[model samples]
Target chain A: MTATLTPAPEKAPRRARASSGASRRRDSGPLERQQSRLFWPFVAPALLVYGLLFLAPIAYAAWTSLYRWDGMGEMEWQGLKNYWILWNDPNFASSIVNTLKILVIGGVITFLCSFLLTLVLREMRAKLFARSVLFFPNLVNAMVFGAVAGFLFSPDGPVNAVLGWVGVETPPKWLGTDNVFTLIMATLIWTATGYYTTIIMAAVDQIPPYLYEAAELEGASAWQRLRHVTIPLAWDVITVCAVLWTVSSVKVFELILLFGGSNAAEPPMQTWTTAVYVYASVFPTGSVPKLGLASAAALVSLVMVGLFTVLLRRLMRRDPIRY
Target chain B: MRGPKIVAAGVMAALALAACGGSPSENGSAEGGGKGEFTYWSMWRADEPQAKVIKAAIDRFQAETGTKVKVEWQGRDIKVKIGPAIAAGKAPDLWDNAADVVSTTVVTGQAADLSSVFDSQVPGEGKKVSELIDTKLVDTLPKDPSGSTKWLVPYELISTGWFYNAADKDLAEQPKTWDELIKLCDALKAKDKPCLASDGELMWENFLTLDLLLVRDNGAGTLAKIFEDKSGAGWDAPGVLESAKRMEQLVKGGYLIKGYDASKYPAQQTNWAQGKAAFLSNGSWVAAEVSTLVGPDWKMGALQIPPTKGGNTEVNVSLIGFSVPKKAENPEPAKRFISYFIKKDNLEKIATEAKNITPRADIPAPAELADVQKQLSSNPVRPVLDNLPREYNQKVLFPAFLEMWHGKISAQEFVAKAKEAHVQYWKTAG
Candidate 1:
């Protein structure tokens, strides 16, 4: 019995020796110094950039938000007065609601379309060609795409021409109608889905081939393998993308401005988003500059985006699976 | 990735070199020798005939005065580029823009008070802009209630009215009255043709029509009171309702081009130019655009909207100008340039090249601009959409007018909503 138990004692001594050696190295100044040297070199550039560009501007905006000054005039300290005005501003409220609608509705539509496309591509033998075709729209800039879409959707445009071919007699005004928000959402989805599908496909690719092989060996069906492996593996990236979409959709302006020529000015109240509202409010088309109010509005928008980001991240949180 | 990196490096190098010596400020200083160069911005490009004429004058002035001038030509979207520069404290000394944008510029305090410059220069320029530019139009500029000029100098005067295809000489010669215009529309319609083509998206054109109708029906004074004074009761006046009723009748009669409600500027103008429509209501700018659609040989003529019963004489002029930024690095040079540019000789050149009438009374009118001149020289010189308070012009008036054009809202409903919006704007603004 003593001889049998003594076989494990040899292994334990070797493990202890290895642990002691590791502890000694950790205690040595040279190893710690080397580790810090390697870490700082990697982090320095990123830290410098963040500090100079993002952090500095955000900090300045916060400071400026507390002042009551026209951008050109002398600064007057106003504490929370600007913020108070923003709370009371009806335009600000409308913008917030509009932005949320676009984000939620547009994001859902985009995600569904991209998700289905990704699955179809993943299953198909012509995946490479199909993926390339789907990704083509993403290569065009949003401004250029918005202009082209405007032409296509205009009253005497191709859409109407097609309707005429079918003898519809009267085609619905796609862009000129008061309910332009629907058109805007449709455009956002059309422009965004291709790029997002590609991203989702890449995420799906990361699901281990071994897992699929194992499932197949176990006689698991294609849908069953996808449910078990693909969804779970790619869920994290998809969630991150959703959060990014929320932020981007809220700030969408180029397309709206380009399509809605600066002076059309219909749908008076709801035509603007937070970004457009801030611009219009500060610039206030055909009015004086209200930079202080604009900055305050910007601060309010930042807070809104920050809160949503936090909530979304919390909603997306999950225990990591160790594959 | 390597290509991008190399390109970025080159850009950085270029930027650094630009920062050192190629900056406008440095170039300006060197060229002007401490007197400083004036940076002038205009919504006209070098490719525009107007720009070429103006540039020639600038070259002449520079040669004679030994003052260097730098101009930044802005395209159609003047505000987008100008607004950023203004916010960045890099605005030009002088900027040419429409009267509609004057209020915004003034509020920014970006415009310099040119009272002294005006007093000294404009009188001697032999144009007497104060007389040539309708006083009612000048009053439209953003100002303190106490009578302080804030932004803009009255520059290019434009007349807004109906432009008709000379190929359809019958419709062009007739329609001297509101009734005649309606009859003309009906006559065209009877022949299976559309009488009018309008860019529904351009709210100002619609607003211009309403203004013209008001002047034609009630008198110019009533029209002035409605816009210049916030007299809301005027909307209930017979002239206002009559104009609205006429517009509604036109809509119902199918006199407007098919799908005119959703048609774009180019499309509507193109229709008129192609002789598919008998009439296009727009400002003097149409001549240049129309030139592109129909050759110069296809005659185009401007005509004031036909008058209504008990109406005053119809008069229309485009209200446009240039302003000096208060924070401009070289205000003196800007003032000098404004004076120099608006001289009789320069104005004549601009009128000839642009194919539009100059506001200068002394400038010899170009033969090509005779059609526009005839329209401008008509009685009552009404300023198109210039008299509305800035807020109303932008927020309430334009949108409400657009709704009427879209046929989504009735004229009566538009008037009611517009009044409400105007009151609300004033309340908030006050």
Candidate 2:
């Protein structure tokens, strides 16, 4: 036992020597040169795939956005006129406004609710089970939610049926054309909060319990501990969640398209988002498709999401704290 | 170094293989691989009655002609996919849809001109297909966007009108004019029953009423002219304001069903079928769509949209039929199939089994469409909205009309908004 305790004194110098050897190897040429030599071999496959599948389509879209083509006809050189046309289009303007509303308003509400849920579930006995229950909505397809919401909010649907039973003579027109976009935003928040809360809960689980107990000993309230420790410690995950929400919100198409639950090819124009505008423009029901206009609209959305992601990352950037 | 070099070679080979992967299958599926085989993509789903009828016909045609047909039941979204397919030179040799949709293919120069098919005789029927079909419907077949070629060979016709439950003998007296129609609605309202039940969110369905009013008050092609006028000067046409005012009166007069503004498709139509409303302004196909809901109290009846001054009393018709793509590998087999498809025995299935109005005048219309067929025979037919571009109708006209119908604006305000929006629409259309 005495010899085992004394081995630490002998092990310290060996550890120091091992670290010095590692640093010496880093200072030398062989390891770095080997990594450089292997770099292309390791990266070339992924680079080729990414360039072909992702960047190439984006480039093609940008190129086509300049010409007025009907997908099967002669290409007319419209240059920047397509963009100018979109700028003047009132419907396209409405789509852009709707996209931004989903990004900002929907994002804020989702994150706030997710954080609150995460905080509550952190102390729960069945935290794992509770987290799973909260995340169940994400597992369900969005189309189901749209169809169910359409049924629930119909004038004589079950929601109103319940209201009637409760003696509420006049229920709000929940599926009214003016109310559709707001309802869509609510559905999005409802579906998204659960997924994000689970992610935040996972991040919170990594936090050592001793920190909370230490804060408790220091007379810190739950809110103050969260404000000081939980947020900062989980800041990276929250940043990632923000980026995910921004991209998904801009691409919110199927929900808006199917919200009213009719087989009608197009939804009401009042509820169009940028993605819906792109789809409807490209594949209008009974008119010649507008490929050029649709390409421009799609690129506009891509650029918007890219900008949002970058801005979010920048704003949420913080130095990572070590354990 | 050797290991890295080998890995690089492997990566390049993999990329090269990946690039080559998309070519083989694409080339293999090329058309005209066999003279006896031709591909067809239908606008109907596999399980629909129309598809079943057509499939039975296809089997019969194959047995008789020794031609093999490979068919894909692409359903309605085929419109969205067909363009790309045509662009890629992977389109089916034969396809069918509503005439207006086929005209879109014609507009894109994808649909082959079928005048020869029209001149060709219906197999064993001893009559030119064109001669057998309704002349008015053929005359109104929508031309391409350039207004040159006719592409659609119509087999079925669907017309727009006011549908009612004919079981009520008192409702048998159809209104002959706009005023009488309003009086009928007013009487129904007095009885605390709704007059007209429409799917307000369905722009095309609601558009039928406005288009009829516009065509009646002004003339045929007036709505088309309104869209074609790049300067938006056509909004100043008196018929435009008159039609707006009439629609406004329908809105303000409490004649429409409650919550009609928010009604999704088939909701109010169901209500109409149940006799909750006196009438529904809808397509003739409403009978077929709601056939399951028909009870003894409900007998489908249709009335021509009441005529107005200078309306020309023209009937609005939509033709659903077949077309051969310009890029088709075997146009002959497709053409042969189309002719066989229209044989008297074969074409009647559209009416008997599918519950639609057949394009052939020789075939009797379905019982539900007796009144529509009678009207079609008597009146000169015109394409829906005088063949207006659907985008213009959906975007510029629908917004103003919806606002008015929702009681958010008056007819005067409708005219103002429509004019302003019409001008804005054309400003950048170029």
Highest lDDT scorer: 2
lDDT of 1 at B31: 45
Candidate 2, chain A: TM-score against the reference: 0.89
Off by over 4 Å in 1: A1-48, A63-70, A74-90, A213-226, A262-270, B1-37, B74-91, B107-110, B115-155, B217-242, B295-297, B328-330, B362-369, B387-391
What share of the reference contacts is kept in model 1?
A: 0.21
DockQ of the two-chain complex in candidate 2: 0.27
Candidate 1, residue A184: how far the Cα is off, in Å: 2.7
The CAPRI class of candidate 1 is: incorrect
Off by over 4 Å in 2: A1-26, A165-167, B1-36, B145-149
Q: Candidate 2 overall Cα lDDT vs. reference?
A: 0.80
lDDT of 1 by residue, B241-273 (tens): 778877777777788887677654466677778
lDDT of each: 0.67, 0.80
Question: For residues A81-192, what per-residue lDDT tens digits would candidate 2 score against the true structure?
Answer: 8899999999999988998999999999999999788778878798888888888999999999887876677778888899999999988878777888899999999999
Per-model TM-score on C-alpha atoms:
0.82, 0.91
Chain B TM-scores per candidate, in order, are 0.80, 0.91
Candidate 2 vs. true structure, TM-score: 0.91
